[model samples]
Target: MSLVNLEAVHKRFGEFEVLSNINLSVSEGEIVAIIGRSGSGKSTLLRCINGLEPVQQGRITVDGTEVTAANADLNNLRQRVGMVFQSYNLFPHLSVERNVTLALKVVRKTPYAEARDIAHEVITKVGLADKFGAYPDELSGGQQQRVAIARSLAMGPKVMLFDEITSALDPELVGEVLRVLEALAADGMTMLLVTHEMKFAKTVGNRTVFMHEGRIHEEGDSRETLEHPRTPELTGFLDAVLH
Candidate 1:
């Protein structure tokens, strides 16, 4: 069964529609990369799925739970859905360990020792085992992004949503964060990401979705869809981005 499913979803800002009649399904462990222009609704789509944005129409479900239900527990839904953003939203004064454990300790009321252990495991998973004691400012942008990823991982979410997480990094540092995603992909973590990294999307994505003017313009196997785009819009987009 699909873990994430959206049917005829719609979202708008005043008269401007951000998402339009969207339908999508993602199975367990699948990696889907959403690529489009700035206003194409990629980020909004993720937000809607995670309940960060409210949709005007359609149903959304994650792991058989109806996210669109009137009384849906958004806070509880968020526990199953982890999101990482363009900015590493770590607390500057907190060590990586503390930053990762904060939600566990405060929100979930996990014991400090238990939270610390979870933090250690996820930090190590992101290859930051040696930097747990470091503060955010002390680490490189890439390392901080990794910490952000580790923090989300520590939540033990069923799915992860990444909103251009590497966009804020220096070009040279982008690879490190992408590598962490690659590792996560290898470990069968279901992920959906909005990204401008064409190569990474093709490499790590099982499917690639091209959105244009709040609609899915094209979607197919990552490598084939990216390499042999069937639509003028996708072709133009690839041409613009690649060259």
Candidate 2:
């Protein structure tokens, strides 16, 4: 069954349209990677699904909540959809454990001891179990991003949305974050991510979506789509980005 669905979704910024006629569905445990050049509404799409950006038209439903509805419980909806961004937005003063558990304690009314336990579980998932007591500044950029991922995982989300997560990392550090994502995929965590790492997308994503002019231009199995793009735009995009 589909955990997330969007139908005829339209988004605009006053006179400028960012997304148009977007219809997409993602099933449970599926990993979809979105790829495109800048200004193609890739990140905007993620925000819309998370209800961070409201759509002008069409419907968005996540885990059966009608996100476009006026009476939809957005806070509850967000709890079910976790998002990790390019920049690791960790609290400078908070320890890694505190950083991961703040939302659990505040939003979910979880107690400190229980929240810390949850933090440990997710921190281990991201391969940062030893860094629990450390502050964000003490870690490398990659370790910081892993903590960000662990923070989202600690929420016990049904689906995770990643918005160009590794873009801010140094090339040498990118693999560490990617490996964490790979482990998540192995464990069957439903994910939809916008990314520039084509090789990782092909290997890890069950499906690849190529966006152009604020719409999904082409999409299919990741390996097939990347290796043998049918559209001229997708073909050109691969050549430009990869070579």
Whole-model lDDT values for every prediction: 0.94, 0.95
Name model 1 segments beyond 4 Å from true. none
Question: Under the 3 Å rule for N, CA and C atoms, how many clashes does model 2 have?
Answer: 0
True-structure RMSD, every candidate: 1.0, 0.8
Tens-digit per-residue lDDT, 1-243, candidate 1: 999999999999999999999999999999999999989999999999988888999999997788888988888878789999899888998999999999898889999999999999999999999999999999999999999999989889999999999999999999889999999999999999999999999999999999999999999999999999999999999999999
**lDDT per residue, candidate 2, 65-153, as tens digits?**
99999999999988889999989888899999999999999999998899989999999989898999999999999999999999989
By TM-score, the best candidate is 2
| TM-score (all chains, Cα) for each model | 0.97, 0.98
- Tell me how many clashing residue pairs each candidate has: 0, 0
